[model samples]
Target: MSTRWYPIYQRGGPQLRVFLPNFWLKLVRPTHEQPPNVVQFACSMEMTKYDIQNYLEKIYNIKVIDVRTRIALGETRRVPVKGYIVKDDDTKYAYVTLPRDEKFVFPNLFPENKEAKKDEEATLEQAKQSLSDFMDKNKERPNMPGWFSI
Candidate 1:
């Protein structure tokens, strides 16, 4: 399987074995509110319900109760500068239901509020320090013109 080859088959052939399963399962943030046991995922378009179930159960070790999938149509828009219309690629969305006792909470990857405040505070502190240092350096030359320097 790693060599990317398939063995020849005879009339009575041995069962084919799959050594590697290269399926990608991305954990996507839910668009809307969902039950605690339900998790959203953006998966390969060719994946089936059985494939998702097996993937989660075997790879992730997450026991899934059920799986539901839907194809989201890509938006079509007309280019503002060009006179042609463009369409986005379609996506497949999967909603996996875990055991009722299980819960999944998506973590906040980008936290803007706290980071922005901390950044603003840092800049304010930096400006204050620079101004204080400037005043200290020119303590004895206060009467000089603003633009004049030694």
Candidate 2:
């Protein structure tokens, strides 16, 4: 019996299969300005156009009009320690085209949070007070070790 992972589909249910790829896809900012409909992604080197199309359509439920991919050759350099030649892994860049009406913008990963900001400010204040206290204690006697005082 084939087990559907999403809804746990069983007998008499519409059987839908999910493809889990061993590789990973990283959403990357475009090096150059691109149309709003075009989204750039850095994917596994082994991924093909068809694989990328299938992955977006089936997994992300994104309708992809076209997919173009290119491989960027890795740089060859000498290792720091033994000066042995080493080569970095080649990377594949996939440009996925969405429908003209649709546009995608990268979301902001770091947004201001009130609680986090407060915590950061508190930590900064504590650090400043600590430094000032240390300076005051050291001002009484110059060149004295900090461990000498309580």
Best by TM-score: 2
Q: Which pairs of residues clash in candidate 1, taking residues 3 or more apart in a chain or in different chains?
A: none
If scored against the real structure, what TM-score would every candidate get?
A: 0.67, 0.75
Each model's lDDT comes to 0.86, 0.87
Q: Which whole-number lDDT from 0 to 100 does residue 43 have in model 1?
A: 89
Return the TM-score for candidate 1, rounded to 2 decimals. 0.67
Clashes of each: 0, 0
**Off by more than 4 A, model 2:** 1-19, 112-126
What RMSD value applies to candidate 2?
5.8
